[model samples]
Target: MSTRHAVRDDLDSRPWTGPTRRYDILKEGAIALAIVAVLTFGLSALFSSPDEPALTFKGWSQSAPDNMYATMVAEMSGSSETAGYGPPYNVNSDGLSIGPLALQKWFGVTHPIDAAQDFVIAPLQSQQQPDAVTAAVSQWTSASADQRTAWATAYEDALNDPAGANGDATKVPAGDYGPVPTLAAAVVAMASSGAYDGALASAGGHFFNTDNTKQTMLMGDGSYMDDLATAGNLQGNTWGMVNETGSWPGQQWLATYSFWYQLPMFNNEDPNNTVATVLTDNADAIIFAIMFVVILLFVFLPFIPGLRSIPRWIPIQRLVWRQYYREYGKR
Candidate 1:
């Protein structure tokens, strides 16, 4: 009896040892990698690539039907980038003085694009008799602003009249228009000859074969951008630039900023659109700063006082080790 009692006491006091299996770390790692590979392959097959293909200037000029705006875009691609962009296009180095106050203006002269020389003259020079185009470019450049304006205005009016397809613009009443028509003709010829891309490339040190800048300028010139803006409900009416591409999620985080644009004060105000844009820009900066601070706080949360104590306050420890608690309680 004494021996049996002693054996029973030893069994009770001894540490509980159940499984004694060796863990192969290499085998576990290999198995994990295999599972990840299979999962990755399945996901890849399920989801395809996301690519937003854009049309180029050459493509649009070839395909787009003759419209008032389309012709305008084609014609204006030379000069429009001047009035359209604030600086770099115009060589306004002081434009970045506004900083975050005018975030758009802050990154000044980063891209030094001379619209007329790059878009118009360069493209024309790409073709045969480049010297002739160069001389014409020189004449246009030397002309007075009033002369250029007169020429541009007259040409713009000429475009308004119903015209032929991909041909010479109808004759303008011969006046002090100077070499305007010739320059305009040069542009048209460049477009017609499909050397427009060559001209644009010439401006970018003849390196960029892509027609992105040319196409963008073209789109803005014609009512293309206006049409797109209208279609996308980005017009000032439908709450300043909400994502209008049919049922797709918008800038979800910017919903509040968008909501401000819908207000009567913003909607009805004459310069509300500009005001809203500025406000949104400022608000975005503030929101970004707040988010950054929050992220930093989260990163160092373990060292934070109140946050570190949250685990104890919630007492999740008791639930996780409930069996150990029961055993301790029984003791």
Candidate 2:
């Protein structure tokens, strides 16, 4: 007989003569269950998720009223990031693309946010305001688009000038801002009183008012959210993806996803570099594609030819069965 056939026949005829221990599967399962339960409850209580209070427009306005005012003006001027975000919002500019795919644009404007009206005008219109504030809103809505842009542009420039008021809304240099300042001031007042949060949330006229898109977008336009994120060390550059707020362990499973962002091409820190810019622009799509391929490879690893043979070639199993090998000699 060939060596392989002889070995298989010998193994088939062989009888075991080794020490054995009694195993009660039911007892073993119960012990395992008790241990797992204790650990689950103990660890969960010890490392519960952070319970920070939800951020509010009222809080933001109270903390940084001047920043809020500038954000409102930016929205009205159609200069805010959301205003030109393009696709899934508006088409003012084309969003990130992968090669010639224009993947973001293909999705189209699903949410359809008119930054000026939705973030600033709509919320204000929903709430009761002074006659001057109402008139300012009317003036804004009635003015030509160019007129509104010009007014907002002039006000934003003045608001941003550090040597001037340095973003202090009340002290901005005098200009032909028309009624924009009045409208902005009204929104600030709303935010300070906490009524602005309700106004934006209930803008859809729903009693439940669960959707917070408009409120979040408005807050995102200001610096307050970014400030909070930086303070918590939750910025993407800080490896925030796997980090929970405070000292708690975050989602470690996202390590693979966050790992790519640490690389230069994906970081977007150097915007002037052509390659970095291209990669950053398409980072989302590219990362997703890479992850998909990685997942496929992982799932098919057992079926791959050379890869599947690695376990056998490495022969780590010999270590596991060392006692048997010592007794019977290497098979």
Candidate 3:
């Protein structure tokens, strides 16, 4: 009877004393919701929407028509990040990988497209009364590779000389230069006239709904891209391209890859740029993925074996249930 009374006295001395009305579930939920709403609105107002640059071919053409060829060449040179961007663009190029694996090429030229013709020539051909431009393009098509190279080389050289503020390219000196300049001029004129986008519309006896190909090609041109890079401070030293006219964050995720270009290893290495870019991108992707997985595991580590026992080992449990220990003694 005395032992029973002692045990009852110990239980009475303990602190918990069953469920207390300390917390109101509804009140806590309302507070959490209010905090979340305030944060969401604040972030929305502070950061705002993502920046979208007004970089249309028409705008570029109107602004700098003389640099069309330089623009075209740049468009041709850069890697088409969207070429095989998959679904909602081109079905064939979708989901195919390219690199050492060559999955894209092995898939057999799916969505077979001639970047030059599709992006440049086709748009010009669609313009009203495009006979002269059409004739020049036809001549270019019939011309030999040497002849085309000669024209391009000559025109490219001619562009080096400065012209008036109106952006008129100096005429090429008399030579065996084919109809490339004339064709290129027509494209410039179309762009200048603000009909470039309208010409891009595939409404004339052909299916040309997809504008991605043309836009991609247009963005690749070196001179145009250089202009844009300059405007946006995307050049190597300034960092990868950002939206030229806005405060939004640029490609922050590519900070590492951008940093690699700053190193001496990639600097002054033009010929190896493609290979280096591909290798660096692949390596970075793998490393990031591994690190992400490691972080996730670390976050949930408390539930893992050999880790859950840490709480007990550290005597934190003893501190938490000190009243129970005082009455019942240590386990």
In Å, residue 312's CA in model 1 sits off its true spot by: 9.4
RMSD values for the candidates in order, in angstroms, are 10.9, 4.1, 9.3
TM-score of 2: 0.87
Write the residue-wise lDDT of candidate 3 on 258-331 in tens digits.
Answer: 66555544444465677655544444344445456656767988768877668858987788889867977764
TM-score of each: 0.53, 0.87, 0.58
User: What's the residue-level lDDT of 75 in candidate 2?
Assistant: 91
Judge candidate 3 at residue 286 and give its lDDT.
40
- List the candidate 2 regions with Cα displacement exceeding 4 Å: 1-28, 305-331
For residues 39-85, write the lDDT of model 1, one tens digit per residue: 98997787643333554455445554344223543343333534455
Task: State the lDDT of candidate 2 residue by residue for 1-331, as single tens digits.
Answer: 8999898768768895555558899999999999999999998998876888889999988998888888988998888988988888899988877678788888788988999888888888897889999999999999999999999989888988889978787788788998989988889899999898888878867788777766777778889998998898787767788888878888889888888877778877675798988998778888877788878888999788888788889999899989868976775
lDDT agreement with native, every candidate: 0.56, 0.85, 0.59
Off by over 4 Å in 1: 1-32, 51-53, 65-82, 92-108, 129-139, 153-189, 202-277, 280-331
Q: How many backbone clashes does candidate 2 have?
A: 0
Model 1, position 228: C-alpha lDDT score: 59
Best by TM-score: 2
